[model samples]
Target chain A: MSTRRLIPGSAELRAEFPILAREVHKRPLIYLDNAATSQKPAPVIAKLVECYERWNANVHRGVHKLSEEATEHYEGARAKIARHIGASDPAEIVFTRGATEAINLVAQTFGRTRLAAGDEVLITALEHHSNIVPWQMICRERGAVLKVVPITDAGDLVAGAFESLLTPRTRLAAFTWVSNALGTVNPVVEMTALARARGITTLVDACQAVPHFALNVRSLDADFLVFSGHKVYGPNGSGVLHGKRALLESLPPWQGGGDMIASVTFEESTWNHVPHKFEAGTPDYPATVALATALDWLSALGWDAVAAHEHTLLAAAEEALGAIQGVRLIGTPAHRSGVLSFTLDGVHPHDLGTVLDRMGVAIRAGHHCAQPVMDRLGVPATARASFSVFNTLEDVAALAAAVRETKRLFGA
Target chain B: MNDLDDLYQEMILGHARQPRNFGALAPCDRSAKGHNPLCGDRVTVYLRMDGERVREIQFDGAGCAICTASASLMTDGVKGLARPAIERVFQDVHELATGKSDGSKDLGKLAVFSGVSAFPMRVKCATLPWHTLLAALDSTSAPVTTE
Candidate 1:
């Protein structure tokens, strides 16, 4: 794997991320927490500043020039996001606070309206809390049952589980495209096809997937998909919910406010169009424009190059970190990406995290918001070091050394 | 790594490895569970009260080194004290862990955790046990959470 050939501009690209040069605790920072949130590049940050400095105004209401410019940039962002994911129409993209809000919108509107008593909402054990909890709330409220498709010990979905789970009573199937905790890439396209065959509406939580590869929602055939901006090296409070045009049009408005209405009376109100009906209040226009900048920057890198770079780092991390004594790798999926989760002998993940932090090697040490996954793995928690395009072989070496130091400190 | 050394002294690590009064107290009078949802660290403090004084105290659950060591030191620190005296010690320990005051005056063996003040995010780990103990004393049914 010649990373230089895979990404010829890798050095220049790495320089674009300013925070990579920062030092934490008097040592140069080795930021391996990309799964939680990715560091923003210079273009994305500059776009945010430009939005605030040049055209900072509410969209769709005012006829002033600033509002018009803001609206163009905001709507332009929607089109860019839709095209990035290969959605058929820009109207399918709904701006959200983040993936959590995006999932909740579908649950509150579509799930609330469509589900009936005795119906089942199928999710997988690999889902983040954002993907699981909304469905749980909707299921409990509608007297619907929540079904979980279990994963194998290696963290992959059990073979034939999706086909078997999709029965007549299963109203919708929601699952993650990648496991944030274990970095296990689910067979989402196949799963979605199975659900569609059984007339089940499918939603893919692509928060972890979008950063690592290109996704085509049309080819995927999932009725809905979601991702957060911050996880994609974009600004926080920016997210996207991509739905099939007809499916989004069929759903009722999730929230009621000024921009979402067509005609309002004290007695009754008529709603706006598909995407606008879902976006109730003033959207985060600046963040949305910056998110578009992030997508453009990422797309310019070419998904193949990004994937190749990250894959190399992830493989190096696995080998280096695994070589240390008593360091147990948690997930060994056939198609893993970007994340390496592990636990050390006689040392808790939190303790490992603290020692690593002292050495400026930042990693996540928790259940990773997948408590059921933690329960299935039969561990309290695991330390996770997720990668990005900016990470290098040296970062992996730093992580390995930090783990060794942590072991020595604990006398493991 | 001065701060790291301060945070994980040999005493703290030893207590974490072999907790003094671990496991549930059978025939216990009062008990409460403490949870730090941030890291999924959990502990249940159990007390066998002899009228106004604590006759025996034990705790059982899984947590990080700081949490387990803090619980171990806490049980050992408050075993013989009466309810009022235990509450006073809790206040002092809380102040010491938060870096409001040094424990040189009265914290005794519990002063091993004075190093925790340097790591603000870990204050909850060192104090979750004390909170559960307070909850047990108050006979609260809800599990104490260090958010």
Candidate 2:
């Protein structure tokens, strides 16, 4: 099926984007590296422009109209995001630079309060370095132990590994909802459910999942969910952290700065309420506004339509890529989103990427910030083409075409 | 600039597949590991020095074509050269490849990599072996590692 009109569904609107409307390398830009970052739609760009042009005031302190407007828009964006992720109250959401910082915030703050010297932190084999490193940093500082839950040969987190790793000393479990490297849609719901049953707090890095699928925090039963806005067609510096209010309230404010504290004195200072306590300095107000607009754009596209279109593209990609000799797909789970990571014989991924770039096709080729995932999959690096709402079956053909070209060039 | 021929010049690919003096020297003297985390390029260079001269040079690892081919050329060029002369070879390679050494150096097979410096990202892949050469010379019995 010709999916050019289906994926982004922006036939009526995408022309408004000055960037996408132009030609790249004399060809229509087919952006398949959505996992690296998705291009912002026109509405998000407009929202960014609106924030800078009209409501250009620092939030939370002023009584004047512009300040009030700025604060309202800022907090309103939070509410929109809260609603987007099935959060009951805006207080449950905190703004972060991106999911990496959000994850670090939890690891540093919550890990400090809940974990002891001997406590163990559980993370899966497929987590991004962002998810893995912060906890390692906190553990190294606090003398707590870090335990990795291994994955199966097929790249699923070995279900039993977590059970054995979960001791009474286990403090928290954090892992990705869907792996960025292997495109493995982890059974995080079942895994998180199990973690919670063992009295271990669970954190899910939903950066890859939330942008592609509908998310209900209650259904996932995760204590904390983190995702970046940029991956969801929003601004780069904005991200969301959805936590249970009780869990959020119990942790100390992560970064000491303005907005996070209600009052400060030389003698003693008390913290602000739940969300703001974590939102330290002046937030990325423009990016946050743009994030809400991106959400609105996605919602208007509708999940059922987006999922249907993506499934078509992904299936075609799998079949076409499988037909090529020496092409190995990383995650082969029955359930997956549209992210595909593969390796071709006798061609370095960077060489493959450079050849594809020459043809005006873009794909991510590297360790994908998941070296451990690369290690698990027994590949040095991979070339990945991730689909967003804007991608089409044509993008799949583009990927296959690029691989064929790469094979020809590499004498494979 | 010279057609993508600058990238896959026959010499570059030929050396990449059949790297000279590759594998390990028997009962090695000094060796080091060079790692490129960006592309996961790794190589262990083996050197056996007869007094101040490098009598034998060898390498074994997995890396991109540029790294492997450059390394292969490097071992061939440095054999029988004194430590100071080998150091001169390092400078000459850097000059020819990085556009620093007056551009008149007849690098033979190494000039195939000069186009790599133009790409910027591949410069390290081309220079990794030479960088490991310095580290291997100093780091005692344990292999010196460079990134």
Candidate 3:
């Protein structure tokens, strides 16, 4: 097959990720699971190793030189993440374990404070379990109902469903910028704007979106936005929650710990500033620095090139897989990212995934933590192949070939 | 195909395509549900007990080849057996599926599951039905999870 170039420098960029060069099952790895967690590049890995070897110290409280440098690096990551998400103030960025924790932090603090009995929290059917369960927990505790906006069979959010559900009892609307299971890029800007017009707060789960393109949370005007570091080729346990500073300041702290406190007595205590109060404990300093390095790398690549390369991979895979005799593509939303979830006739997703693994094509299979979407689509699970900047047309071809092989094994 | 032949053997595939006892039993005396949330595999085992013996046993659900086939084989292996006899078969099958023991001669057709121990992640799939059987025997309603 002839190689097709989408981005000018993407070929060279692929070399930056060392893991891409390795072999799996005696064949060169065709890493297509980027939507799950991207493989880290050399610079991001180097930054993590450098942090531990050069300056390993706790942040915010230590008086020594190593402590001051560690504090600088950690806070610098906070600033870099703030700018990456288009937040105006660094104080609005709070580091959490990942996107799940970020959403839970908002649900526990903001959801607890604002929501009252009979209030409603709205989300779409396209949500991952992380986006759904946290609100379910908070709403259950607060006597609030959880309302779901319907989606069309094409996996697009239903037009007017958002507005129809935006009743007076609706206190908050939290939804994903992109569906992890379906790859449907949601119209979050219009959804957030509609919710804001109705005086309801909004939070956007950009965990799938932030990796593919540049996101301007301020431009979207959502009260809160979140993304995971690992999904963007950074270290695990690194994530950022960006909130409007005024909104964050008014919400009470969720978890109490050493760093989140400004003053403490036996009977009385005062909380720290907005970000620190939400952070609660000692943060993963090295991972945060590596996350910033990842942002710097993506910023250098620019969103245009990243999206172009990924779209080429997605389009190629879609065409090739859709042409196969028994392959049924799960979602073909009008607007989508690089995720492709599909099923082969007579082949269970687990069986397909096992066969693909032997061919050195790593893909995700199962409900993808979006059982509602799977139920809506009338499937138990799907085999999903998500593309990233480093993925090429060859990778898509390999995936299509492996899928064909899976069909053959099932005598299809 | 050669690499996965051990996992999706012809016998397993045949059973998956046509699983035995793949329906709910009416007048079922005991029943329990088993679910593997990771893969969305769910099975509800129903048993009709005549005193301490199982008169009829069946399972109804959706799962991968290994899971469905295992449940099919399990009902065939344990039906009409007394409580203690079924318990003994369960122990032998568990050991075989988990690589703890080679096939016992008494286990008869259940020896096909010995290949399951090679794939660690799949061991749970092969044993989910057996666990659900135990749950049914104990008359517990809580769903078992192979996390």
Candidate 4:
């Protein structure tokens, strides 16, 4: 296929997702909440159907042709994801339920074995609870301290405070490559490099980054990296966890079940090798293949063009929202992804969100499961809109138009 | 602009604009902070009762019009009623808002929030203050669950 742009045009982009074909309160649906979860494209849905129709079987234990084919497809998905992220070895990648589970696996297995009392783990203010809560649980259990790196008012990480927090006792530094709440694309390459010099484990929750930007874990120097499949137009209940070979080899198995054991006995049992060791039970066979197909499609649309398309939407939205009176945009960092969070002076976010929904413009309006970030911003809640490659300038305009109508209705 | 078509009614806007009995009471006997995590609706209910008679009730917080108006009306609903009667009123208001109990419902201007139940997502916004007032009657730290 020729390297044509994903945004054939605003109308063309709007036609891809069949969900957008539906009406909301008799108005056209303008979904702008990609940050929460994106609508799956037709190709991704077709891939799901194809997996069930042709390649459906239990993987890795049967010598039958069907099982062999299913195993091959599952492993093929692993390879596709590994290649997409520039992962050096396919064995470095492990299939997980989603990014949340992948992060939990590291915290449970690695944290249980590698860390102990007085050891500290550093996380940032920008993390979703998925990243923060798991580490907090592990730290509390293992008698380790959890340190939080603050962020500037502009939504940029307070680099100086982060540097100051680093100590010899610090065992790991986990942060998002791009924040899901605020769109700040954290400089993980610099962050990982700094941690490595101090012999600290560097973890990157790249669920938000892998969807919108090009990434190479080797270049970023991340000891562990994770991204979810659903957010990238793949099927749900699938994710990828990439870890350095030596590090994965050292950690113990997280769950005990089928496909993770080499041999089992009444008394003793042995575990499977690296990637297989982490993947327990019957894996999500069809969803895994679809995730790989989605990644393949994203690869075909080169990151540069994809990034440019998303930037266009973000620029359009920022300019339009700024022009409206009493509208304040949160997370105005110089470097950000396409997510936009904002508040109007007199309108409650709940009421504002309700108005937006009735107008067929869907945006997230709440704490977004990141209450800490909300507290930091001094807002009880704010309405949020996130963009993706499929979105266009027109969608941003719909959001602005909806906000203005809300202001008018509320007499703000 | 009379737009009942808007999610908020005039009573809701009025309460939000000039909230009656708004602000913290003087060293209240019972107080509890109730927060709706989803919408960030928060209300602190302060009550001072004399024996079985309700003396005073006040509240303060950041919330949507539904919650603010509900808080404002809640004070009026239980001001003259006794303790047992107040509890019954709580039940009656809950039943009325949820469409269980109708005629003779002493909901007052809270009747405006009857439209809110249609939007399931906004239900908590209307009930946040009621939950806070429930807590303020007699409770300790840590949020008390209504559902």
Give per-candidate clash totals: 0, 4, 0, 0
Least accurate 10 contiguous residues by lDDT in model 3 chain A: A1-10
For residues A1-412, what per-residue lDDT tens digits would candidate 4 score against the true structure?
Answer: 1245455235665566778789987888888888888788777888888778887789997899888998899898888888988987999999999999999999999899988999999999989999999999999999999999998898889867777888999999999988888899888888898899999998999988988988998898899999899888788898989999899999999999988999999998899998999999999988889898888777777788888888888888999999999999988987989688899989888888888898888999988878888899898988999888777678888899989998887788
The sequence of per-residue lDDT tens digits that candidate 3 reaches over residues B13-129 is: 888889998899987999999998877789999999988888899999989888899999999988788878878888888898788884445677677777777667678888888
True contacts kept of 1: 0.89
Residue-level error in angstroms, candidate 3, position B36: 0.4
- Which predicted model would earn the best lDDT? 1
Overall local distance difference test of candidate 3: 0.89
Which DockQ value does candidate 4 get? 0.59
- Per-prediction TM-score: 0.98, 0.93, 0.96, 0.95
Q: Indicate the TM-score of model 4.
A: 0.95
TM-score of chain A of each: 0.98, 0.95, 0.97, 0.97
Ten contiguous residues minimizing lDDT sum, candidate 2 chain B: B138-147
Q: Over the stretch A1-412, how does candidate 1's per-residue lDDT look in tens digits?
A: 1133224126777778899788999999889999999999898999999999999999999999999999999999999888899986999999999999999999999899999999999999999999999999999999999999999999999999878888899999999999999999999999999999888999999999999999999899999999999999999999999998899999999999989999999999999998999999999999999998888888777788888888889889899988999999998999998799999999999999999999999999999999999999988999999999888888899999999999999899
Judging by TM-score against the true structure, name the best candidate: 1
Best-first order by TM-score: 1, 3, 4, 2
Predictions' DockQ, in order: 0.92, 0.47, 0.70, 0.59
lDDT of 4 by residue, B1-147 (tens): 122363477677777767888999988778889888777788888888786566898999888877788788888777866767777776776665666665676566656766665576776777777777767776556664434
Q: Order the candidates by DockQ, highest first — what do you get?
A: 1, 3, 4, 2
Per-residue lDDT over A1-412 for candidate 3, one digit per residue giving the tens place of the 0 to 100 score: 0133334226677788899889988899998888889999898999999999988999998999999999999999889888888888999999999999999999999899999999999999999999999999999999999999988889998899999999999999999999999899998899999999999999999999988889898789999999899999899999989999999999999999889999999999999998999887888999999999998887677688888877877888889999999999998899999699998887778878878988999999899999999999989999999988888888888999999887777786
Clash pairs detected, candidate 3: none
